[model samples]
Target: MSPQQKALVIPKKQGNFELSSRSIPSPGAGQLLVKIQSAALNPVDYKIRDAGLFVTHYPAVVGTDIAGIVEELGEGVVNFRKGDRVLAHGKFTNDFAGFQQYTLTDASFSAKIPSSESFDSAATVPLGLDTALVGLYGDQLGAGITPPWTESVGESKTPIVILGGSSSVGSYKLVKDYGATHFFDRNLSGKQLLAAISKVTDAPIELVYDAISLPETQSVAWELLANNGTLVLTLPASVKEDEGKGRKVIQTFASPHAPQNNELCQSSWAMVEKWLSEGTIRPNKYEVLPNGLEGVIGGLERMKLGQVSGTKLVAHPQETQ
Candidate 1:
C-alpha cells in the first residue's frame, strides 16, 4: 500500500468536513510532492462547503493557499530539490489540494520561500495577490491595464480607488507597497470617498478595484468611475452599466490554472521570489488556528459567520492527529 496521510475531506456536495486518511500522491512531470506545513483559509473555502460551487467529485478535498517543504521532485523539475521550503497556489483536486498532510504542486505555480519569511506568511500571498494581479492585468478577466513592471506605464500618477472592507490592513499595506497613493477609512460614505479622491488629484478616477464588492461599495465605485473607466470587482457587479458611457465592470477570476490566466500567472509567479526577497511585495498578516487540520472546521465556520476579520487564518497540517 502507498503511504497515507491525514486529510480533511468533504464526503459529498455541501457536506461537512471530517478528518480522514488518504494515500499520498506522487508528483508527475513538472510537479513536486510537498509536505504541507501551513494552509490558510479563505472565504471561498466555506463558500464551497455551503454552495458546492466548484467540486464535482465526491469525497473531495478543497484548499488553495499553501506553504510547505518539498519532499520529492518530479521529472523535468530542476528548480527545486528535496527539503526546500516553498509556497504554492493549490487546486481543488484532492491530490493538488492544500487540506492535507501531503499534496502535489505544479512547479510553475510554486516558489521558494525566502529566509526572511515563514510558512504561515508565505501561505497568505498566493490567493490574494494573484486575485489582485489578475484583476488588474488580465485582458479577458481583468481591466487589461499594463502591468506596473513594464516600461513607464505612467500609472503612478493615475488615480486609483480601492473599496476594501474594514479588515483591510493587510490589503491596504500591499497596495501601498505596489504604489497606492491614498487610503480611506472604510466607514466613509461614497460621497465622502469621492470627495477625498478629488482633493488628492485632478485626474479622473480611471480604475477602481472594488476588493469588497458589496452592493453598497459597488454602487459607490460605479458612481466614482469616469467615462471609459474600468471598475474591477471581486464579486458580481451590483450596479448596471450605462450603455452610452464606455465604462466596464470586470469580476475577476483568480485561479492560476485557468487557461486564460495561465501564462500571465506563470510570468508573475516567476517574479514572486524576487518580490519577497527585496521586500517589493509583502505577505498578509495571519493568525494561526489551533488543532492543526481539525481546527480548519471551526475556522471555516467563523469565516461563514463573518467573524474572522483583518488577518488570514492558517492551520498547521503537520500537527494533524
Candidate 2:
C-alpha cells in the first residue's frame, strides 16, 4: 500500500472540505482495509460536508455509501479476505470513515458482492436499500405483510406510496424487489396517482411510504390512508397532519448500530442483488463521475442544487489508479 492516499475530509470547526493524503489505514481486530472502488454520493453526504455535524476527528473522512475490494483483513475477520469484492455503508454515527481511498470497516459492516452487478450500481444500493428494508419490512413496520423471503405471501398485494418518489433513495426503494407490493407516487395527482397505485398493489391505497419531507407532497398519503393502515415517513412524524381515519404513523430512521436493523440491511441487500440479477428491478440511472478524491466538492455542489435528476452521482476512487 502507498504511504498515504487522498480522502475527502472536513474539519471539525469549518464547513469547507478537501481531499488530502494520509496514511493508508490498516484493519484492526475484526476489521477490513477496503480499497474503495466506488463511492456513491447521497444528500447526507453534502449535509455533513456543509454542516460538519457528524465528526469525531479534526479532519475527518466523509460520505458513507461505498463499494470496493478487500485489500487486507485484520485478525478474526473470517467473512472477507484479500481481493474479495464487498460493499458497505460507512458509519456516520461513530465518525464512520468515508470518501477515503481506503478506510477501515468492521466485517459486520461489509458484505460479499453479487456477481451480476457492476461496482457502480452495487455501490448505490447499501444505504438506501438498508433504509427501505428496515423501514418497510422490519418487524416494527412490515410485520403482517410477509417479506419476499417466504413464499407464504405468494403474490402478496400491498399498496406502498413513495412520497418523495423522485429522489435517489426513494426511486431505488420503489423499484426494488418486493414480491407483488403495489407502489404509488405520492407527488402525483388524484386519478393519475390512483391508477398507478392500482397497477401494483392489492391494498386499497391505504398503506404508504412517504419519502418526501414536504407538507404539500405528504397531504395525499395522510388522506389516502385506510382505516388502521400504516404510514412510514422519513421525516419526523410530529409534523404530520392529523389523519381523521384510524392510522399509524412511523418515523423512519436508518442506523448501523441497531441489531434487528443489521439483519434487515443484510436481507435487503441480498434481495436487491437477486432483483438486479433476475432483471426484476432496473438499476437506478446514475450520472457516473469518475474522479479521484479531488472531485468531492464539485459532486456535493451538484447534489445540493438538485442538478442530478433521476440519476445519483458517483465517485470512483480507483480512478486514481
Candidate 3:
C-alpha cells in the first residue's frame, strides 16, 4: 500500500475545502514526484469548490499553480532528477493531482526553475502568463512561435490595448512579458480614458484584450476598435457579434485538453523563465502563509474573502508532512 500523505481537499458534495490525510503517490514512468513547496490559488479554485461538479470524487485535491523540489524521477525522465527545483501547472484530476505533500506529474509539464526566482514568485505566474500569450499570439502563427509581435510584421508595429491593465494576467503581460503598445484600465472614465487610449494608440485602438466583463467596457472597446480590427475577451465570444469586416473576436480558454493550442502556454513560460533570470519580473508581493498542507484551507478562505490584492497567496505544503 502507498503511504498516506496530507493535502488540502475539497469534498465532492460541496462546501469549503479542508486539510486531510491522503495517499502519497509514487511517480510512474515518464513522471516525477515533486515535494510541493508552494502553490498559488486562482478564482477557479473557489468556483470549482462551489460548483462541486468538477471534482471527480469526494476528498479530491485542488490547486493548479505549483512550485517545488523534485523528490524522485520515474523511468524515461531524463531531463530532471532528485533535488532539482521545478514548477508546474497543477490541474488536479482523478489521475494527476497537485495539492499534496508529494504529487506526480509528467516531465514535459514541468520545467526547471530559473536560478534567480523563488518558488512563491514563480508560482503565481504560469496561468496568468499563458492567458496573456494566448490573447496576443494565438491564431496568427501556424508554426514556430517567436517572441516580440513586432518581429512578425517587419517593423509595422500593431498596437494592442489590454482592457484591464491591473488584472493578474493583464498586469503581468503589461509589466513583464508581451508589452502591449497600449493599455486601458477599466477604472478610467470618459474623456480621460479615451485620451489615454488615443495617446497610446496613434490610430485609435484597433486590437483590444478585454479582461473586464463589464457591459460598458465592451461598448467602449467596440467603439475604439478600428474596422477590421481584432478583439480578445476573457469571457464568452458570444458577447459580441462580429461584423466580419476583418474584425475577429476571440474567446480565450486556458485549458489542459487542447495541448495543440498551448503554444501560447509554452511561449509564455519561456518568457517568464527568461524574465525571472533577468530580474525583469519581480514576485507579486506575497502574503506567505505558515508552511504546511494544513495551512492551505485558511489561506484559500482568505483568498475567497479577497483580502490579498496585487499579492499572491501561497502555502508551503511540504513542511506539514
Report the lDDT tens digits of candidate 3 across residue range 67-114.
889988899889788998888766657335656777886676677788
RMSD of each: 1.8, 3.7, 3.6
lDDT of 2 by residue, 1-321 (tens): 657777777756565776667788677787888888888887777776666655656777777777888888899988677998887878763224658788777677677767877778867766676666667777764423546664555553455666665666577566545343444444476556766665665467666777765566566666666677787776666444456766777766665546656666655544554566776655456666756666667878887887776676778886753
lDDT for predicted candidate 1 compared with the true structure:
0.88
Q: What is the overall TM-score of model 1 with all chains considered together?
A: 0.95
The list of candidate 1 runs beyond 4 A from truth reads: 150-155, 165-178
Q: Candidate 1 — which pairs collide?
A: none
Tens-place lDDT per residue, model 1, 18-91, is: 99999999999999999999999998888888899889997999899999999999999999999999999998
Best by TM-score: 1
**Could you estimate the TM-score for every candidate?**
0.95, 0.82, 0.83
**Model 2 accuracy (lDDT, Cα):** 0.68
Computed on alpha carbons, the lDDT of every model, listed in order, comes to 0.88, 0.68, 0.68
Per-residue lDDT of 174 in model 3: 65
